[model samples]
Target: MKKIIEIKDFTKSFGSQTAVDNLSFDVYEGDIFAFLGSNGSGKTTTIRCLLDIYTPDSGTLHLFGRPYEFSMSKDIGYLPEERGIYTRSRVIDLFVYFGNLRGISTKDALDNAHQYLERVGLIEHKDKQVSQLSSGMQQKVQVGLALQHHPRLLLLDEPFKGLDPLNRQLFIEMFKELKEQGVTIVYSTHVIDEAQRLTDRLVIINDGKRKAYGTTEEVRKTHGSEHIHLEFTGKFPKRSELYTSVSTTKTAEIIPNKGVDPEEILQELLASDLRIISFRIDLPSLNEVFIALSKDE
Candidate 1:
């Protein structure tokens, strides 16, 4: 895939506190890249540098093959972690206002506002004041505003925050639709489950550093972890020697040490006196990997 955004040795600091330190990564075109990190892990700061909201103390950021600056802002849509609106403003009115700020004409902005309201299933509430909508509805409105201008790239910071399951599903469906239309997206979140489902590639950040990056499978492999789930019918058998390569033999489930064949281990179990009724081998979820890495810190 073509590269759309590149951060080369980017570093930023506020006083003596370093928010981002020598971060480097590439966002490929047409990718739903998940930016995973805990609070204060430099997610927002890196995004600010990418958007030129803050001039980095060092390094460079390229957006769409050019140096990043506020000039490129119109080509990108951003949904900040904090959701805000003029409470007294009508839903459609707010959309129109924000769209116009994004360079859409008033007439066309209002038309697209209504269209996006309907698209997000908020058409019935278009005439209502922003304060009249529930918190969830307000969040959806922010998303609608972000999409109003048909931006080439979308930067969503904690988009799923404060959403119920149904609304979260709605956002996921909308992201899938956006991906289908070839929109490159950078989604930042601390929620691992949502990231795992919505993203094909991910960059895991911690302490202002890149902890892991790549396709989900590739990241898992590089961390020397696998999803190996095993359930024995009877009492769990004693630890096996061959399983130690990737596993902590103390537990039934194994973490591969050197990509050992789990089937070979199973075969040895069957040959031994251990009785087994059930077994399963599944990939470790992102949450598991995240926890493992965090513990290593």
Candidate 2:
């Protein structure tokens, strides 16, 4: 696949403080590349520099195989973490204004906005003022505005923030639809669970530095996390042999301190006359990996 975005040694500093330190990664065309970081971990700063909102003190960023520019930005859609809308503007008017700014004609913008509103199940609120809409409704509207111009690349910063469970599900469904249509998405979020569900690849950052960058499977493998949940009859096997930590009960979870093939571990447990009721090699959840990485940091 062609490269959609690339950042090389991208660094940014504010006076004595550094926000992004030598961060580098590539986003492939048609991939949902997730930017995972905690608060103040430089996720936003990195995105700002990538979007040309902040000029980096050092390093380079290229989009679509060339240097980024204002004209290139026209082909991009951004939904920032900080949501904003004209509080008094009518819903239809707000979408039209934003879409028109992105080169859609006023009439077409309104028509498309109405379509999006209907799709998002907010068509009944079209004539309402922005302030009249609930927080979730407003968020969906902001997303509609960003998408109104039908850009190929979307930069979403915490798109699920402030959304209820139902609304969050709606956004997830929408993202899946967009991804199926080959839209390149750069999703930034502190919510690792959501990222894990949507992303094909993930870049994790901490303390203004890259902690991990690769496919989700690669990262988990590099971290050496064996997500094997084991069930044994009688007493649990000698904890030291299987792993340093093995939770005992109906299902014993063996998390080794070193690399041990889960199959081998299971075989050993069974060979030792340990009645194996059930065993499974569960992949490590992103949230679990995040916690482990954060603790290591």
Candidate 3:
């Protein structure tokens, strides 16, 4: 696949503090990529630099195999973490206006927005003013607008924030559909579980540094230990080495030692006093990896 986004030694700073430091990564075309980090980890700063809203102190960025230019923005769509809406305008108008900025006509924008509203279950709220809508509703509107011109590259920052469970699932389904159509998406989010489940590849940065990068499984495997979580029917064993930690009577995390397979631990448990009720390998979530790497940093 062609590379859709590239950042090499991308550095950005404000006054005495560096926001991003020596970051390098690639997002391939048609990939559902994730940029993940905590609040002060340069997720938004790096996004702004890509959007031309902030000039970086150093480094380079490329979109669609070329150096980023303001004129090239029409090919990209952005839904920022901080939602922006003209409070006085109707929800439909805002979406149409956003579409207009991306070179879509009023009639097409409205038609498209209507379809999106229908999908988001917010069709009735189209005529309502932005001020009348809740932040979550406004967020839904922003998502509709981002799809106005059917951008080739969608850049979303905290896209699932402020959404209820149903709406969150709706958005996830929406993005999954977009990916199937071959749209390249790079989304920034701190939430780990959802990212772990959906992303094709991800980069986890902490304190403005690249802590981990690659496919979700690859990054997690590289940074943190995988746990064989066991729930037994009796007392746990007094074990060492590969037997890492226990949370309760029936549950524990067993880290495989060097060349020891997780199956070996299960084999040991099978012959122990406890009767096994569950034997499952729990791969470390991205959040787990983040905490481990951040502590080291």
Candidate 4:
């Protein structure tokens, strides 16, 4: 895949507090890249730097293999973490205005707006004032406007925030369809479940640094410990020469040393007197791995 966005040693500061420090990552073409972090972990700030909404104190950013340029704005659609729209304007009218900025005619913008509204299941609310719509509805409007011009790259900061399950699903479906059409998508969020399901690659920031970065599996393998979950018939092993950090219960968790294979360990258990009923490899979930690394940071 081609590199869509690249940030090299990106650092940003506000007053005296560092928001992002020496962060480096790459977003590939036609990928749904997840910009993941917990609250105040610099997800938004990194995105702002990518969009040139905020300038970095140090480091380099490249979008589409080039430095920041206003002309490129039309090719990149951005939906900020704080989703907002012109409260006084009709939803459809707002789309028209934003589309015009991207050089679309009013007639074309209206057509595009309604088409997007239909996909997002908000066509009935198109003529309503932005202030009158619910927060979720307003979010749909913001997304509609962002996509009005069908930009090649979509940068959505916390796109699923403040959304009900149904509405979130709607955006997920829309994004999947867009991805199928080969549009590169980058969305930032603190919600791990959504990111796990939606993303092809992920970069997780913690305390202004990259805690994890790569394909989900790569990141997991890097920072997430591989473990064996064993359910035994009797005499749970609390201490083993092969495994440490043995957590006991009806089902016990045995965290082996790095590079230890579960299959090799299984042979040892079979040689013992302890009756083993079942065993499975337990790879840490993205949420668990991220929280663990974030806490360490």
Q: Cα RMSD to native, each candidate?
A: 3.1, 2.4, 1.9, 2.9
Per-candidate Cα lDDT values, in order, are: 0.81, 0.83, 0.85, 0.85
Candidate 1 clash total? Answer: 8
lDDT of 3 by residue, 41-156 (tens): 99999989977789988888888887778666677888889977798999888887787777778898888888888877789998999899887787777777777667899999
For residues 1-297, what per-residue lDDT tens digits would candidate 2 score against the true structure? 798999999999999999999989999988999999899999888888888889999998888988777777557888888878898999998887777677778888888887898898999999999899998888888888888766789998888787889878888887888889888999889899878778999899888898888998888787656677777676677657557654666667777656667777777777786788888876677887877787788
Better of 1 and 2 by lDDT: 2
All candidates: TM-score: 0.89, 0.90, 0.92, 0.86
The best candidate by lDDT is: 3
The stretch of ten residues in a row with the least summed lDDT in candidate 3 is 238-247
Count of clashing residue pairs in every prediction: 8, 0, 0, 0
Instruction: Please give the RMSD of candidate 3 to the true structure.
Output: 1.9
Error of 3 at 260 (Å): 4.1
Candidate 4, poorest ten consecutive residues by summed lDDT = 238-247
Which ranges of candidate 4 are over 4 A from the true structure? Answer: 229-253, 257-261, 264-278
lDDT of 1 by residue, 154-227 (tens): 99888888888888998899899889999999989999988888898999888788888999777767875554
Cα lDDT of model 4 overall?
0.85
Model 4 C-alpha lDDT per residue in residues 1-297, reported as the tens digit of each score: 789998999999999999999999999999999988888989899888887889899998999998778778778898888877789988888888888887778888888888888877888988889899988787677778778778899999888878778778888898999999899999988889778878899998887898888998888788878878888876665445678755565677778876778888888778777788888897767887888888895
Give the CA lDDT, 0 to 100, for residue 134 in model 4: 89
- Candidate that beats the other on TM-score, 3 or 4, i.e. the better one: 3
